[model samples]
Target: MRTALSMTLSSFGANRVDFASRIHEALSRVQRGDIDVVLSDLSLSHPFDGLRLLEELKTRNLLKQSAVFMIVTAEANAQTVLSAAELAPDDYLLKPFSGETLRQRLVKAVAKKQAFKVVDQAILQHDYLRALAECNARIEERDPYVIDFMRLKARLSLLTGAFLEARQTYEQVLRIRPAPWARMGLGKSLFRLKDYPNARRVFESVLAENPYAMEAYDGLAGCLEAQEDLLSAQEVLSRAAARSPAIIQRQRQLGELAQRNADWPVAVDAFRNTIEYARYSFQHDAGDYAQLSQSLLASGETQSAEQTLAQVRRAFHTPQSDLLAHVMEYGIASARGDAVRAGKSLQAAREQFAELKDNLPGTYSVALAEACYRAGDEQAGKEVVSSLLRNQHDDVAVLRKVEQMFVAVGRESEGKALIEDHANDVVELNNAAVRMAQAGDLEGAVHHFLSALAERPGSMPVALNAISAVLAYVGQHGWHDAYMQLAQDLLARVGAQDPTNGKYQKMMQAYRMVRQQFGIKGA
Candidate 1:
């Protein structure tokens, strides 16, 4: 698939094509935004395949944007094609084709992609309204690719937060063919509308017919999580990760869920695999190393835990990773009754974080807080939790972590009070902003929303509402670079919180529109 395709493309005046031999290298390039188009094959070295690569791209939402991806399979197996629908590849080329056929297919794919530049550009700028209009215009003109435009319209509606319209569009597509991607889109819309029971059934049916669908597993897991069936959620993720170990994101979640279940053995293995697999991708997080060492300590393997900590210190050298390693070492020493070392490490972290209030990522801050609490500086730990809560008042995961950290320090009452008070404060702030907007004081509304965001950076609801007000003001007034940047920062924070958030898709659309209005590139 590599050497031969290169030769074929070269025959057609292709200037350059990187033939990647390692899965990790190719995935790293994709994550780094180095590849604008990807042509992959079904089979590869063990534990790696084109589908897994496509799954990662889809999860990152790269497939829908500027990049063009095509998968070459040896045979057009019904299930393989059906499962591949989830990623919505540009085109699939069956094997045993002549050079002319391959050339023609490539030519057609490239042409369609070029023609899609306008729609793609608008989406890149987050102007889903413009994108939707362009798509409708194309459809009304009865373009030969009208079916394709219909699918694009549905996706645009979904991105625009037009849930009902998205649902209708999906249904319209499904009538022509029962594609898993379309059906899954319907399920997603249902999930967004909070119709869990129906969403669950649709996801189940998707997996039933196309068991290899990665998004189906994610959707089913979402359904389980919403129901608060942590055990089932863990099992669902466990099964999915087992089949697709290359999915390091799922592996990380499995580790978290395992810890919550007190399944230390599973947590240890999951963290270990996450650390190992992350070495192969550009998606490394120092937080996983901490999780591994802590899980080892939880399982009563102090020596092994310390060894793991030493390895982490050697493997990653970023400031955050350094802090993470120190925290883990302190955690290990505290577990072993080495008070002196624990206290020293706690002081080191405190000194590093002394000047900055909201400098570190939430996960890193929480890790430091845990280590500090264990090292006997309960106040420092509580303060970190307070900072995190102020930003992410509605993040259930952060809230749970806050509860756990505070309860460990014998400050459960204070933690609960802090949570309630800050959550209500954010709500009041947003309510006041809404009132301002209603009273035709859009500028005041934007001001209060910005202040609310300053107090609580991780609140997606607040960020979304703030973004709405800013975009409205921009539409009525004019584009200001300051407001655009504020909206951009909030979107970045939202992404830092959870890129997979359903609302995240909608917010990015608005963010693009703001950037477009400001005549700015998305970079």
Candidate 2:
């Protein structure tokens, strides 16, 4: 009852009009700061309609603990109600409704928002652990909309790498309502846990509900990709892109699929669109320019390819930016039928890399090897690849690159033999570590992992799992200080190298648990 009075007072203090003006200003302010509520007329202008506004807000962010967004419509109908419900506004009211409905909605919204206030703030600040804790606290609150609360918390858990907690919340949400998002969340958790079949099943269920759900399609494609089903992954990306042409990410996904299959033209087009969309947003990436240049060269548009390379070299002046610049310049020189110039340029690149002196992994060596081979120095190219293999002996991608370099230099048999030797070494070393782990000699297993890493520091799987096993063993040791030190080191290494490695993430989660249990700093 006093809300109108409070609104009037607040409006005077803030130099606003009436309650409606205050609400409008508040809703507009949502983008600037975290809005706790929204009040708008359902029947507004084209893009300013209440439903459209709510949809935009939902897509930008889900609900926060203290976010109490509502819709006030002129008239309620099946269509309007369904739309509002689908967006899951905190409260919905028919226009010409009494103050009672507004008050009721406000009170309910405020209560729900307060319940989630801590979590919302934490998540907004990217403190996912706090969000998960808050959500877990409200998992069984006596509210009809607790399911939404639980789902929100589960999402935070997933972001925080609390996969087990996220999986539990997802299951709970599914039991209450088979929401497509919840199903997708479960699939995502299963994927994180490496349960591909279950993840595929969950993604399929999401598709059954909404066949054009791009997220589900992407997730399904990821499942296929993990299983090495490139054809199926390509098909999935193709279908998703066809279904949602407006999704720039889907286009980029298709581009990646095309590039993986060596479809240069498709890759170029898709990456071009991706770069276009990225120019104005947070998705912008310098690598896109380099990739576009590579694709252009692959398509035999040598002049256009050189132009693309020039753009990247001129536009980005950072240290690592020169890597792609050098790579593309070498390619362009070789394409122009000037092996002599190409050789000189590649030699300069090699000298530059040597001056840097192992600051990065053997990436420069591999790239340079390819350039030298293309420039007709077959023996020099072979030596370059051999040096790289010596540094990163167990990295499959690096090994593949080396093999390609050898084949380009007319040394296919040498390349095959080299790869086979490394493969045999990896298999034996990995098998020994596995046996050590199974035999409960975790300390010995950890030593083996360290040794394997010394042998091939760039092997993502071997290095990541090695760190994971160490963290897991540390968790069992009750050595909180040692655990924290090792955990932070692993996190730094992962951040430096393969940040996307799932096992590295598992170690991160284990680290978090140890930190939480021991009340360690940076938890």
Candidate 3:
């Protein structure tokens, strides 16, 4: 205990307590966050005893909060240990423990806490970069607590949209400790990366460890959903929701899944529960309201759905915020068999979107398409779908809405052709370059990408890919200045287009890494 305290004193900068028999005075210092661990006698004569001290720390949510509450009592009974465990002190120390044992425990505790602290603070504040940096530092420490660090860091990485990094972190953590949380993280990361087979393996492994790991169940469902295995996804989420009845998010997700599957009753129940639980979070979107309205409409609850739409409008006033509400209002009007009101509502929604056409291509297309569909102008609906099909070649969300419109207008074949063509074009371009590169034809790959970019000048992915290939070629040919200048110009354009595009941001990072490695300078 002395060795641990001494190490804590040196490493974490905790103040030293006088070696006195009065444990309360020492614990008083511990409460001030000056100490990160408390090695105290179970019995104390102070107004607040050791158990009281533990409870106080837990309530304050301080650094010393449950920091290591060691009983240090010779009378270690099952009842006392059970009570201690219930209070959730990290580790319990028995009486007559050696200094080395104490040292190991404290070291492990400190390392785990230090590794987790950065992630905890980052999560508390939603600062992902600091969390990732801290995780990397902890990974370098090579301590036994590295798995915990990796698990936490993987979650942060996923939040920051660093799915590949999160996947690597989860893989490393699972190598050390095949815990349910780590496996869940791995599954989620792989799911994000669209690796369904591997993701399913990770999720199944999590269920193998803990069948009640509801999060893994949700992840497995998500993987199935991504693969368009909707039936399996529904079964997975339904089982999870049934097993763990308290997680509102899971229920909400299940509702969304059920809604997508057109299981209206289940969707309505899930969404209702979701709204009940998500009333306080900033993450609460009008999506639940919109989903509920749709589900209610599907269930023939016309009056309730209309009321929900009205409430959504009162809650969120912006056209963008209330787009779904307006759409739902149109749905309600349709349900009431009021063709005149339905046409008016759809027209108003279309106008609302048109005014912001430059900023909302998808919204404009969707609103106009819906307006035309209900107005019985099949030609106008076709035009709207065509416009969206042209402008939203790579956006899955927009494309899906377009597909929905296609189904509504009964132009299923045209819709299939349009979506498949755009997707295939992109896949072909990406695949050709990748194949050439793999076949040791780097120059040929660059040429093909450049020609493709010239043909489709505004294609961000293609343009960026061309630049990347050229940069690779230029680096090999010792044309550092030319490539660096081109990269700078391309990066500036990417920033102008959208500072949040992952491919562009990654290309920029690669440029920086290369420059740093080679000490390359711009001309």
lDDT of 2 by residue, 207-300 (tens): 7766645568888998997887877888888776565443456667777677768888878988887776555434455667766877888898
lDDT of 1: 0.75
Instruction: Estimate TM-scores for all models.
Output: 0.81, 0.62, 0.59
Give per-residue CA lDDT, model 3, range 440-463, as digits (tens).
Answer: 787898889878766554456776
TM-score for candidate 3: 0.59
TM-score sort, best first: 1, 2, 3
Candidate 1: stretches off by over 4 Å: 22-37, 43-48, 55-67, 73-84, 93-101, 111-115, 139-143, 156-164, 373-378, 394-397, 400-416, 433-523
Give me the displacement of residue 115 in model 1, in angstroms: 4.6
What is the TM-score of candidate 1? 0.81
Q: Which candidate is the best by lDDT?
A: 1
Q: Give the winner by TM-score: 1 or 3.
A: 1
Predicted candidate 1 versus true structure: per-residue lDDT over 1-523, tens digit per residue: 5678789878977777776655667766665654657887774223456776776665555454546777776744634544535457777777777779877877778777765676766664455666788988988898877767887788667655688988888888789887678888888888877788888899889888776776777778878877878899888888777656766778888898888788999999999888887776656777888888888988999999988988888888877777777788788888999989987887777777664546666788878887767666767876877777776667676787777667756778977887888888877887898899889999999888878777765567878888888888987798777887777777787766555455666677766766677687754
Span of 10 residues, lowest total lDDT, candidate 3: 78-87
lDDT of each: 0.75, 0.65, 0.65
The TM-score leader among the candidates is 1
